[model samples]
Target: MSQSRILVTGGSGRLGQMVLDQLLHAGVSGIITTTRTPDKLGAYASLGVDLRHADLNDPQTLSKAFQGADRLLLISTDDLFSGRRVQQHTNAIDAAKRAGVRHIHYTSMPEPEASTAIPFSSDHVATEATIRESDLSYTILRVAWYAENPVELGLIPAALRTGTWLTSAGAGRIAYVTRSDVARAAAAALVRDKETSQIYDITGPHAMSAAELAAALSRSVDRPIEVRQVDDTALARELVASGVSPQLAPMLVTTDANTRAGNFERVSHAVQELTGVPPTSFESFLVKNKARLLGATDK
Candidate 1:
């Protein structure tokens, strides 16, 4: 197989970093990554990755950064609150087309076309449409929720502290895939040979409900954790009280409401098929990050 000159945006980000590492490990040569600040990515440069300055909000930098790259991993920017993320993504797509990029692998949400309940889904749906219209061979990776989200956002820690997990998502199950697994899938897709646009629902092997998640947390931490389902209004109030911004509280509540409506219940084998490894389960993720979940510092 001929090696594709790969360029990845958001390479310094959480998931993007994982994708970069996976590409390097897979021996994918001629890899390039773009960052607004090249000095911040000196380590990647030392590893022989071509680091360039490219900002999604700045269209002039994108074409030069994408020059000579056949495949581009366009990691979606996390500017949901500003309502300009879709525009930024469209800018990237347009620049990729102008630079003659052949294939684009985008990180999108699972089944964004099915629901308008998730506020961020609109950005992804619009971006996917733009990519389709760009005449580029594309791979749309519809990723599931990350297992690390709950732990990183203080949800699990709050439950551990209060002995109760408060949720507006009643009886809704999510097939949570870890960030590492998603990155691996992205790496696989970037190098694979394909003639047509493909969409992959990158999800975990199975789905688990809120109650099941609480029970798993209890078992992992060796404590009793209770599940409390509340309405969106009550959830929003609690979120605000817990230091979440007043403006963002309602969005979080809506996320749970969407979950309860079963928008995140799809499970898929795409992770294994793409990365040659099964997606990590929620139970295993919790066990692996037990110290972090239990508020213990790494030694």
Candidate 2:
């Protein structure tokens, strides 16, 4: 165990895998990645990438995972609204400090400062505050909305099925960030010669309204689409009814409220400076994923 090792939690996730790939592409040495299920990451293991099953929820597992790592990347768990998730982060932070990890990089939301409406942001802000007060050096990447988030999970599927992108973001403008940019920025921070222990707001190139984004998607997919505002309360209820868990409803509601309040609009230069490339444009995303996105329509 040496101080040169870098440990990345959530290493098997889409964004984490991208970070791992970029790191391997750079031939950076001493990278360690942890997953809840190591078997699924056999591809990475085959490439001689260090993989371990270390669930942050377990204190003992987290302690072992944090061992010998000079820097840690806490990619924030996806358990959207559980208090236990926040507690899991607290455990990781505690374990990292105890292990004498020099630095930590945490992925957070766009405007944590203005995201009081969102329960998720509160957790993010609390964890960030804890990091600042702790002796261990820390860097927080408050990322903007992922361009892929909308297309992959939130809107595109529904838009394709119903010809409308329904959301609560009434007139809010969003600067769509990309997961690849987040990954690249993370890799830079992990391998940089100098430590960056401050908060960096990573964002995409342009800001657009929900209507504008829907128009862009329609143009890309060659289909007619409309952006419609949905009731946040009803959406929450539907999510709960559809087995999204009652605990998560508030988080979704708060997030949509934040969106409606225009908290996702801020732009920043951190991505370009950190990754040595500008964040991908929304149009670029459509171009790259058009085939997959429009496959259903084409068939």
Task: Please give the distance, in angstroms, between residue 185's alpha carbon in candidate 2 and its true position after superposition.
Answer: 1.2
In model 2, residue pairs whose N, Cα or C atoms come closer than 3 Å (at least 3 residues apart or on different chains), thus clashing, are none
Per-residue lDDT of model 1, residues 1-299, tens digit only: 44879999998889888999999999888899998888888898888899999999999988899899989999999888798899899989999999988999999998787757887888999999999999999999999988887766656766777788888998888888899999999998888887479999999888888899999988987889999898988987886665555765665676687788888999989989987899988988898988877763221
What is the C-alpha local distance difference test score of each model? 0.86, 0.79
TM-score for each predicted model, relative to the true structure: 0.95, 0.87
Cα lDDT of model 2 by residue, 73-176, tens digit: 99989886567777878888998998888898899887786888866677887888888877788889888878876544434654676786666767878888
TM-score of candidate 1 on Cα atoms, chains taken together: 0.95
Q: After superposition, how far is residue 17 of candidate 1 from its true place, in Å?
A: 0.8
**For model 1, where is the 10-residue window of minimal lDDT?**
290-299
Candidate 2, residue 10: the lDDT equals: 94
